[model samples]
Target: MIRVRVVTSRRLHVASLSTCTTPDSLLAYGSRILHCPDPHKKVALTFECQNRWKSEALPVYTGSLWGSDEAPGLPARGPRPELLAPKKMPSMKQLQTQASIPVIMLHALAHIELGAIDNYWDTLVRFDPVKFQLPRDFYDDFLTVAGDEARHFQMVDNRLRELGSEYGALPATRALLEHAANTAADLAARIAIVPLVQEARGLDSGDRLVHRMKSMGDKESAKVVEQIVWEERNHVRCGMKWFQHLAKVQKREQDQVAYFQELVLQFFPDGLPGPFDVEARQEANMGTEWYESLESKVAHPSGVKLEKRGDTQSASVAAFAASKKKVILAGSVWPERTSSAAGVRSADIIQVLQERGYQVLCVSPSRLNDHTSKLQEEQGVRCIQADANTDIFQKLLLETMPQLVVFDRFIAEEMYGWQAKKYSPEALRVLDLQDVHFIRRAREFAVKKQGLNFKETLDGEQLDIDPVEKIAIRELASIHRSDLTLYVSDFERDLLVSRFQVPDMNLHRCDFFYPAIDVSKLNSFNDRRHIAFIGSFKHSPNVDAVEWAKKHIMPVYRNLGGDAEVHIYGSYGETKRFVKLNDPKQGFFMKGFAPDAHETLSQYRLSIAPLRFGAGIKGKIADSWFVGTPCVSTSIGAEGMSLDGLQWGGTIADTPDTFASEMLHLYNDEARWDVAHQAGVAACSARYDASRNGDSLMERLERTMVEKRELREKNWMGRILWSENYRATEYMSRYIHAKNDGVNNGVK
Candidate 1:
C-alpha cells in the first residue's frame, strides 16, 4: 500500500509514516494543522508542510504495512471563520450590487479552497490503502492536488488581506465539506461528484467570474482566479483520470457517460444543476458529450427524448397534418363536475381550442373499462383512453398528430410527455401545473408539523422543505422537461423562478382562466344566511382548514353575536374522522357532499376558508364569487385569486377573531357586501371571462407552436434532457410494462 510520509526539518529526511497506522501521531505536524481551527494558521502550516515535502535531500523510508492502525477521520469544524447556514450567504446578484462584492466573493472562494485542502488530505489519510489497496500513484496524485489547493487558498487569502479583509472576517457555508462528508465511504463517488461534478462546475464558471472581476477593475484578483481556473482544470483532469482508472479496475466500460450519470443520480437528488463550462471540461478530458449527458440528467426535469427522423414520409405527413392545427391534451384523469375548478377550466379550454379551428383530443391514461365514454358524452369533448404503458398510446399520438400537446399536470407530463416527443417530435409540449404539487405538499407539511396557527404561511417566511427532497426532484424534472409550464398563481410562478431557480421564460401564468363565471346569472346578495366552507375533504389542507374554523373561528363568531350556523360542506365530512367535528347546536354542521355546489353555496351570504398552507389559487374563493357569496379567508386562501379584501368579494384574515369579525361584518352590512359582490362580478367579467382568457391561452399556444424550434433552442436544458436523459425513463417504463404483461399472461 502506498503511503504519504512526513519529511522532518532536523535530518532533511523523509520518515516512515503510515497515515492510518499511527493512532496518535499521523505525521504530528500535518495532523496538528488538520485539527487547527484558525483558517489563517491552518493554511500557513499546510504551506510549510508542502515546502518540506518538496525538499530534494528528503530520504525515503520503506516499512511493513501495519494491520492494526486506525485511519484519521475528518477534522472538527473550526471556531474561527464562522460557519453559517446556506441561507445566510447573500445571493450572487445581491453581492454584485454591493460595493465590495469582489472581495467578499474572493474570501468565500479562499474558504472553499481551504476546505478543499483539508478534504484531499483527509481522504489521503482516512482511506487506508491496506484495506482497499489503491495504487501508489493514487496517493501521489491526491497529495499533489492537496498541495495545489493550499497554494490556491494562499492566493485568495492574500488577495483578501490586500482588500483590507481576512478569510475569517466573513461567514462561509459548509457546502464544500458537506459534499466531502456525503461521499466519505465511497471512493468512486468522491471522485465523480467532487472533481467531475463539483470541480467541473468551477471550470464552467471560472471564465465568467474572471471576466466579471476584470470588469470590476480588480485585475490582480482576476489574474489570481484566472490562474486558479487553469490549474483547477488539472484537478478535474486528475479526478476524471482516477475515476476512469477505478472504473477499469472494477471491470466497468471505458469512457461510459451512462456510468457517470448513474453515479450523479446515486449521489444527487436533482441531477447536475447547470449552465456548464464546456471548454474547460474538454480541457480536463471530460468530453462535451459526457458533460451534456450529466447536464441532461440534472437540468432536465423530464428525461430528454431523441427525435427519430428516420422516416421522411412520416415527417412530411406530420408537417402537412400540423397545418390543420391539431392539439392533444393529456391528463391523469378526466375532470368531473361543472362546479369543479379543474373541470370548468378543462371545458373552457376545449371550447376555445375548437372555436379557434384546432382539432383537440383529450386523452387520459384510464383503463378501457373506466368512465371515459361517459365523460366524453357529458363534457361534449371527444375523450380517449390511451394507456401510457402500451404502444397504443404511441399509436394514438401518431394518428392524432398533434401540433401542440398539453400535459394536464406534472404527473401527466412524466407519464406521457416522452411519447409526445417520440411520436410527435414537432409538437409543442406544455405542462399545465395544476398548482405545483411539491409546493402544496411542502405547505401541508408545515401545517401538520407546526399546527394551523403557524405564522410562517401568512408572514411570507420562505417555506423550506415541508416537501421531502424526493418530491422536489420529481416536480423540478417535470418543469424542466416541458417546453413551458402554466401556473395558475403568480405567487407560485414567482416561487418557482426565485426559490426553485426555474428559468422565468419556461413559466406561463394565467390565473384568470380557471374562474370563469357568467356575471349576469349570479344571484344578488339578498336574503342569504349562515357562514359556509366547501372543499373536497380528501385534500389535507381542506380538512385542516375546517378543523381550524371549528376551533378558532366558531367560538369568536358565537361570542360576537353572530347567530348564523356555520355549514361545512365536502364529500368526506361524514367520514369516520370528521363526524366528530359536527355539532348542530353549536351552529357548526357538516353538510356532506352537495350534488350541486353552486346551488347549495348560492344560499349562503358569505364563505370562509381559513387555509393555513397550500399552493395555487383557491377554488373556494372563486366559487363564492361565482355564486355572489362574499368570502373571508386567510392570506393563504386568497393566494392566486388576485384579490385585495373587498376588491374581489373576499376579506383575508389570518387571526381567528379577525376571521370571525370579517365574516360577521360581510354577512350583516348590506352596503359592504354589495361592494364586494359587485367587485367579484367585475373580476369575473374582466379577468375570468372564459372567452377572453381562452383566446389569450389559444394565442399563446399558437405562438408557441409557430416558434417551436426557436423555443427549443432557447430552452437548451430541456432540449438536452429530452434528447439524452429521456431514453433511460423510456426503456425503464417499457421494461415495467413488459414485466406487468408477463405477470398478467401467466395469471390467465
Candidate 2:
C-alpha cells in the first residue's frame, strides 16, 4: 500500500510510488499528479511521472482510459502563493518602467510556469484519448513542454532569490489556467487556446521583456528570459503543427486563416493586444498578414465608438471641429520626440493642415507613447486609435464623413482607401507616396550589386523580381486611384508620370518642409568640430552608410591628419547590431539615438550622407542645412533636391576616395567650410523654407478637395482599381466583420 506523510510548505513527504503506484497508462499517471495535495508536490510528481513514462516504467495509453468520460475532474492542490483577481496583476509596461515591479513580474511569470506544467499534465489526462487519435509525437511534444516549463520555473525562481525576493513574496492570478480550462475536454480547442493563442502571446511580449531587462542593467536575468523566449518558439511551433494536423483531419485545410481566426475569436473575444513581436511569430509560422487580418476581424466587429480625449488642445479642437469641415489624416505613423525623417514630415504636414482650418484628426493604430501623447496634447491634433485594417476604421470614416482623407503611403491606401471611398465617397482620397518605393527598391538592388558599376545595372534596366514588381504595381495602382498623389521630390514626380505612366493630372509636387531656422540660435561654423551622421539605423541604407564610412572613409580621413571623428547618431532597434563596428582607434564612434536630431547636428561642423541608394530628399543632408552645417553626400543622397550645382551648400560625391577628399578639404580649409556652410543656408532657404513649402502643400490639399470629382474622372485607372478590385476586399472585410459580430453575440 502507498503511504502519504504529512507535508509542510517547505518540504515534500511522499512514499516511493514506483512499487505501489503502478500507473498503467498516461491518464493514470496524470490523475496521480493532478490530484497531488500540494502545489510543489504536484510539480514534483509531474516530473517524476514524466521521467518514469519516458523510461517506460509507466506505460503509454495505446487504446483508451477504461472510463475516460467518467474520469474525475482536475483536483485541488495545496496552495500558499495566494491567487488574486486579474485586476491585481501588474502590466508589462509598468513592470518595465519601475524597478520594484520586475520582481513582482518575475514572481508572476514563475506562477505562470507552474500553472503551465500543470496545464500540460491536465490536458493529457482529462481529454478522451481515442477521440483525438493523437500520434505518439503529440505526447512527446507535451511532455517536452512540461519539462521546459519546469526548468523555466527554476530559472525565474533562482532570479527572484538573486533579487532578495522569493516566489511567494507576491500574489499572482489564475488567469492562465482559467483560460486553459475553456477547452479542458476538447483537444483542438486546447491546442488553439493554449499554445497558438496563449504561448504565442508570450512570444509577442518576449523581446520587450528582454529589452527592458537589459535597459535595467540586469543582463544575467535578461539572458535567462531571452533563452526562454527562444525555446518557447518550439512550443508554439508544436501547437501550430498539431493544430494544422487536426484541421486537415477535419477538412478545414482550405480556410486555415479563417478557422484559426474563428477559434481565437471564440476564446478571446476582444482580440489580442499589440504591438506584437512580428519577428518571433513569423519564426513560429504565424505570419503577420494571417494574424493581423484576424486582429482586425475580432477587435472591431460591428463598429467602434470614437472617444475624443478631453484634454487641453484635443478638447479645443473637438469643440472647433464640431462646427468646421473635418479632414481625417489616417496613417499608422505617429510623431515622436526622437522621430524618423518620415515622422517629422508627417508632423509638419498635419500641423499645416490644422492651421489651414481643416480640423485634422490624425488616426493612428494605437496610442504610441508619452512622446506622441505629449505631441498631440501640444499640437491640438487629436489622434484616434482606429487601425485602418479594422471594421472600426470603416465606421470611423462613416461617422466622421470627412471632406478629405490622406493615406500616408501606398500600403496605408491599400489597407483603408477603399473603405474611405465606400463610406465617405465624397471625401477626396490623397495618396502621399513620400517618394516612390519601387524606385527606391530598384535603386537599392542596383546599389547592393555594387562590384559592378550601378550605372550599368540601374540605367534602363529592371530587377525582374517580385518585390520590385509588386511595389511597382501596387504603388502605381495607388497613384491611379487617388485624386492627388503627393511627391516630395520633383525627380520622383516626373519618374511616376514618365516611367510608370501615372497621369500627370493626378500628381502633385510638394517638397519636404524643413522647419524655419532661428538665425539667432544658430551654432557658428567656428564653434563646431567633428563630422556627424544622423539617420535612424533602423533604415537599411543608413546602416550601410555607417558600415561603409567606418571601413572606407574613416581610416583615410584620420590618416590624412584630420583629428575630428565621424560620430554616428540614430535611433537603434538593436544596438548590438552596430556595436561590433565601434572602434575608437579608427576615429569612428557609434552614438546611439539622439534626443534631438537637430540639436545634435548643430554641434557638428559637418555631416556625411554616403547613401548609395534611396529615394526622395535625404533628411541628413536637408536637416544638416537647417542646423547650420554642410554635408558631403553621394548623388543618391543629394538626389531630388536641385542642389546639384549649389555653391553654398553640400557637395555630392560617388566614390569613397572623392568623398574622403571632400571631407578633408572642408575640414582643413576654413574658407571652403564657410562657403559650403553658407551654401547649405542658401539651399535651406531655397528648397525647404517651411513658409513656402508648407503653404504650397496646404494650397494643393485645398485644391484637390475642391476639384476631387474632375480629378477622379480624368484618371480612368482610378475608377477601375476603386471599383473592380476594391469589390473583393470590401466584401471580404464585411464577411469577417459579420463573423466577428456573431462571435461576440454568441459568447456566454
Candidate 3:
C-alpha cells in the first residue's frame, strides 16, 4: 500500500510519497505519482482480507453484525463497507483546492525577485552606470528590491523543501522575468509592468490559494500564503510610488492612469487586461482615478523604427576638390621589385579610410588583369592596374581622375610622377618615404665589405651613395615634384629634412599603421615555448639575423642543456645554405612563409630579430609585439620603437656572447619572461590602437587638404612655371603612348 502527504515550509508547497518498498523503487514511483493531474494534500489507505478455515465459510459484516456464524453449510460473502471505500479519490477542483494560496503567491514573488537580481548584477558589471545618468536613488531602490527578493526566494525555497521536494523538482516559469530583462533599457516601464502589474495579479491569485488550502484542512500551508500576501502589498506600493513620481517630474499632465496605459500599449501590447486589485493597489498608494484611467487604454506594443542614410557622395567630392598635396614614399628594392612594405601601408590607409566612411581606390601592379578585377568583386574595393613606368599609366590616370595619388618610392619617375602632374594637376600627390634607400644600401655594402668605410661603396656609383642612393635620387626628385611626402619614422623624416635637404613644406611624418588582425585569437604567453626568428627571409637583414642566431645563439641553449627549439620563419624558400644551417639535429626548424605572421608568432616563447643592419621599421618586430611574444634584437633592429626604459622584451644584445646569455636567461627565468611578454603586449596595444593613431591620420588628411587648397591659390604663378617645365616631359610621354598604340594596332 502507498500513501502520499503534501507539506509546506517557509511558505513553499511540495508533495512527499512513502511505500513499503526499496528506497530507489519508492522514489521512482513517487516521482510518477506526484506528476499526476490530481492534486491532494494527503491520501492514506488500509487493506484487510480473511484467513481460510473450514469448507463452509461465514459472512463478514460491520456495525450490527459482529462475527456471523451461520450453520456450517452457509455460503460466504465478500469484505465490508470500510474496505470498499479504501480507494478514496478527489476531483480536479478538490485537488486544486488542496494547494496553499500563500505558497502560490510566493512563487510569483520569486519571479520578479529573480528578475531584479539578474538586472542588478548585469547593470553593475556589464553596463557601467558612470557612462549614463542612472541616479543614486535608482540604485538604492534596486538594492532594496534585491534584498527583499533574496528573502522571497529563500521563503519559497524553504516551503518547497518542507513539502518533501526541492525547488528544481517542479516545473517553473520565467516568463515575467524574461520580459523584464527584455525591457531593461527603460527602467520605469520595468517597475510599472513587472512589479506593479504582474505582481498585483499575484496578490489576487494568493487569496485563492489560501481559500483552497484552508478548505482541504492544510491550515499550516494556508498560513504561509497569508504571510506573502501581507508583504507583497508593500512591494506593489513601491512600484506605484515610483511610477507616479516619474509622471509628475516629467510633467505628464495626461492622467497618470492614462499615461501608464499608454506606456503599456507602447511597451507591452500583448499584456493581459485586468480587473485589478483595487484595494491592494490603493493600499500601495495608487489612486483609484489613476487605476481607472489605466484600464481604459488598450493597445499593443509596436516595433521601434530606425532610420537609414545613403552613401556620402558629397563628402567625397568635397575632399577631392579641396587641394593638391604631394606625398613621397621611398624604399622599394625587394625580390618582387614591388615593395611589400608599401603594399602593407596602402592596405592600412585604405582600411582606416573605410572605417571612417570614406570612398577609396587602390592601384597595384598585381591588379593589371583579371586578378585585380576578381579582387575588386570579392573585397568590394575599386582597384586599377597601371604601370608606374608607362605613358599609358598617365592616360589611365587622366581617365580615372582620382583626387589623391600616393607614390611609394620613385618606381617609375618618367611614368607616374611627371605624368600625374601633366594629366591630373588637381590631384593631391603624396610620397611615402619607406626608408632612406641610399643610406641603407651604403650601410649594407659597408657591412658586406667588413669595414666602416662608407665612401668605398659610393666611389664608383654614378648615383653618389650606393645601390640604394640611385633609387633615392629618383625618389627625392619625385618628392620635389609632389605636394606632400609621408615618412614612416621621425628618424626617416629628419634624415630627409636635415641630411637630404628636402624642403619642410613637402614633408609630413606619418608613422606606420600596424595591420589590424584578430588580437583576441592569440593565446596567452603561458602556452608558448621555443625561440622564434620571424621576418622576410629574402631581405638581407633578416637572412643575416637568422644565420647569426643559428651560429651564435643555438649553441648556448645546447650548452645550457635546456629544451628550447629555434624556429626560423618568414616568406622565402630554404636555399642550400639555409638548409645546411637549419639541421634538425641542432633543434633548428625552418618554417617558410607565414601568411598570418602574428598567428604563427603567438606560439613561440620568444622572438629574435638580431638584424645586423636595416633601414626603416621592421614589420617582424612589430608583429612579435602584437602577439605579446617578447623579442631579442640589436639596437638597430629596435630603433624607432620609442619603447623607453621598457625591458627590450628580452635584450638588445649586439654581441654573440651577450645575445646567447640574454637568450638563456629569458628562456630559463619564468618571472623575467612573463614581465617581458606583458610589456610587449601592452606596448603594441597602446601604440597601435586604431582609435588613437587612426584619428590623428584623419585629422592630418583633413589639414593637408585645406593647406593644399591654400597653396594652389597662393602659387598660381608656380603652377604656370611648373606647367611650362612639364611640357617637355608631357611630349615625351605622349610620343611613347602613341608608339605603343601603333605597335599594338600593327600586330593586330
Top candidate when judged by lDDT against the true structure = 2
Assess each prediction's global lDDT (C-alpha) against the native.
Answer: 0.69, 0.71, 0.53
What TM-score, over all chains together, does every model reach? Answer: 0.55, 0.67, 0.50
Model 3, residue 92: distance off in Å is 90
The residue-by-residue lDDT of candidate 1 on 167-232, one tens digit each, is 877677866667667877877777888888878888877766776798789988887887687777
RMSD of each: 22.7, 10.6, 31.9
Candidate with more favorable, higher lDDT: 2 or 3: 2
Model 3: ten consecutive residues of lowest lDDT: 41-50
Residue 488: error of model 3 in Å?
1.7
- Ordered by TM-score, highest first, the candidates read 2, 1, 3
Angstrom error of the Cα, residue 123, model 1: value is 44
Residue-level lDDT of model 3, residues 1-748, one tens digit each, is 5554333332112223343432222112223222222211101110010111012231211122211111111111112101112134333354346444443444444444444444332332222233333444544454444445445555555665676543333223434335535545555566666666666766646655666667667665665555556566666766776676667655664576677777776765534344344435544555334433233213223442222112442242344334243222211211121224545655566566667766555443322333334434544445444433344355555555666666655443323566666677766777666665555655665666455532333222222354445355555665666677766666566666776676676676565575454557666656888988877644667777787778877787688675788888765434434656767988898876577676788898888877766667777777788777888877667766655665555567767677777777887778898888777766666566666677887776667766887765554433553575644444554554454344334422
Off by over 4 Å in 3: 1-342, 364-374, 388-392, 412-414, 450-468, 514-525, 560-562, 644-647, 709-735, 741-748
Model 2 per-residue lDDT tens digits across residues 215-313: 678877776777677678878888888888878877887886678888888877667666555546655756544566555333333355434344664
Q: How many angstroms is residue 368 displaced in model 1 relative to the true structure, after the best TM-score fit?
A: 4.4
Best by TM-score: 2
The lowest-lDDT stretch of 10 consecutive residues in candidate 2 is 62-71
